[model samples]
Structure formats: C-alpha cells, structure tokens
Target: MIIDESLPGKEECVGSLKNILDALYVLNGKWKLALILCLVQSSKRFNEIQNEITGISSKILAKELKDLELNDFIKRNVYPTTPVSIIYEATEYALTLKNVIGELSAWGEQHREKVKQSMRKQS
Candidate 1:
C-alpha cells in the first residue's frame, strides 16, 4: 500500500483532528461561548444569566448550563434561601480558554473590517 507523502502520518493527523472536532462538538452552539464568557466574570443565578444574555430563552439557557456543567466547564451551586437559587460559575478549565477567546475576538474584529472593505468596494 502506498502512503501519501503529502500528508502527515494518519495517526498524528487523525488524532489531532478528532480532538478538535470533539471540542467543537461540545462547544458547538452560539450560546455556549457567550455563556462561558459571562460566567467568567462572576457566578450568576439562572435568571441573572438569562437577563445578561439578551436573546437566550429560558429553555435554551437551562439546556446550555446543563451541558456546560456536564463538560466540567462550569460549576453549579445550590443556595437554600426562601427560594432555592442555582448559581453557575466558570471553572478553571474554562479559564484555560481565555487565550482562545481573545484570539477569536481579535480575528472577528479583523474579519468585520475585511467585510466592510469588501462592501465598500462593491458599492
């Protein structure tokens, strides 16, 4: 069997690709990153999170929080008060993504400018 010299060995390439895909699968929604960012600043109750993230619905927020919790990206706490309160806080694992988020933000700004330039040329 002939191996493709143009590409890295299958084990190396596939393993890295699989890891990236798995990460994307876990963090795949529009809201997950936003939610993580919000929680990075401080722990917040469910309603507080919902209020901060303008477009997220109650059901979606609930689902996203559960997903984050499952991934160990956030910690959920229960407070026994007159009414029980649930709070979500970003875990240290989530803070590891700070550089990733910062790079994405910088790239996004660059992309926005690129789009604006293209539109200007078209008009």
Candidate 2:
C-alpha cells in the first residue's frame, strides 16, 4: 500500500495507536456506531435493528440515524408506500469497516475478560 506521509509511520503503528483511535471516533458510543455496522452488512428495517440491538428506544435510534447520516456513515431511505417503510444501509466509507469491526470485537472480548479477571481478583 502507498503509505501517506501524513498518516502514521509503520514503526509508530504498534500499541493502542491512532489508526484504531480514528476508527473508534466513528464507531464509538453504546448504540450509535454498532447500529451503523449492523446495518452495513445489509439493508435492514428500523424495527429489525431495534429488536436486535435491544434497549435502544425509537427516539434514540432516530437520533443515531440522523447523526450517522450527517457523518455520511449511513444512508436512510424511506418508501412512500401506504405504510411508509424505512431502511438503513451503510455508506461506502462505512462499509470499509469489515476488518475494523472484527478487530474491535476481538479487542472488546479480551478487555471484557481482563475486567472479569480483575473483578475476581479484587473479590
């Protein structure tokens, strides 16, 4: 890959670096970023996403959608049918997160275990 000089050098890429930090900025938050990634795999109905995410109120979901749309991470399409259906899909930029999402999930899994171990030790 043609590395950009403005970007971090290969030697500085070790440890908890900014490449991942930049990703977390977009994918951070309890339900906001996760919702975007979940929708990215395929177009999903609003209710479907809500049901899977759990504990996300319709209002919050609506707000998250607006934020993601504003950031160009997601796109919302509404059909003018009798019942008016809405679907959310990830944009090209957001679609670049397949590997990122995997890395985060793995990191989170390890972090969760470390926390559990600490709690056990403290107890």
Which run of 10 residues does model 1 get worst, by summed lDDT?
1-10
Candidate 1 stretches with Cα past 4 Å from truth are: 1-12, 113-123
Give the TM-scores of the predictions, in the order they appear. 0.80, 0.70
Which runs in model 2 stand beyond 4 Å of their true positions? Answer: 1-25, 116-123
Per-residue lDDT for 1-123 in model 1, tens only?
A: 657667668999999999999989889998999999999999999989999999999999999999999999999999897788888999999998899889888898979988798989999
Clashing pairs for model 2 are none
Point to the candidate with the largest TM-score. Answer: 1
Using lDDT as the measure, the top candidate is 1
Candidate 2 backbone overlaps, count: 0
Q: How good is model 1 by TM-score?
A: 0.80
Candidate 2 lDDT, tens digit per residue, 1-123? 657658666768764477768656765678876887788768898889888888999999888888888888898898999899888988998877678678878888979978798889999
Overall lDDT per candidate, in order of appearance: 0.92, 0.81
Model 2: per-residue Cα lDDT at residue 47: 89
